[model samples]
Target: MLRYYGVDLLDLHRGTLSARRVLVLIRHLPRDSALVRALHGEEADWGAVEHLLAAVVDHLAIGNWLFTSAHGDSEPPRPEPVPRPGDAREEETAATPSPRELAAFFGGL
Candidate 1:
């Protein structure tokens, strides 16, 4: 009896996954556009759902599941380095840009 994130792999393998069961599993997942649609019962393909579960399982096996955010941002979070007692370099804080700078940045794209 294999289980991935508390969902029984037997249900997937047996092709007996129900909408209610899918709803329960999806609710525990991170909030995103596709998930929002699923929550509203907009998408209803059992095979696609099964494929999604398989993909998640594969990702988990590779230990890169949390590397991407719900919004699909590939940039991983960086940990801040701890300064030593006698460090010569000072840590520079990130400055908040003005609205004009923000507009210009997005406008360039």
Candidate 2:
């Protein structure tokens, strides 16, 4: 399954839209995988990049169902809490999307 690594949005000037670069990483692909050809960007706009990332995240979450039998589990493992920076006590829940949402997301694709 694909995992969310992180995204970095960079530009020459802060808060400016000119010459921005968006780099995204989703784990599990080999270094020489042809999938990189589709994901690599040269001068793509922010909106398109954001949409692609969203679609990818949704796809991975839903695609896990295909391997449920092999895993011998009906439910996926619960995600661990992500600690917030500068606040040791603060944590964020990483909830998996509902089945209905996954259905809709895949249907649209």
Q: Please tell me which predicted candidate would have the highest TM-score against the true structure.
A: 2
For candidate 2, the 10 contiguous residues with the lowest summed lDDT are 1-10
lDDT for model 1: 0.54
How many clashes in each candidate? 0, 0
Residue-by-residue lDDT tens digits, candidate 1, 1-109: 1233566756865888776777777656543345544564423233355657766666574455354544465755543333333334553434667788898999954
Error of 2 at 22 (Å): 30
User: So what's the TM-score on candidate 2?
Assistant: 0.24
For all candidates in order, the CA lDDT equals 0.54, 0.46
* Residue 90 shift from truth in candidate 2, angstroms: 23
In angstroms, what RMSD does candidate 2 have relative to the true structure? 18.1
Best by lDDT: 1
What TM-score, computed on C-alpha atoms, does each candidate reach? 0.20, 0.24
- Report how far off residue 18 is in candidate 1 (Å): 1.6
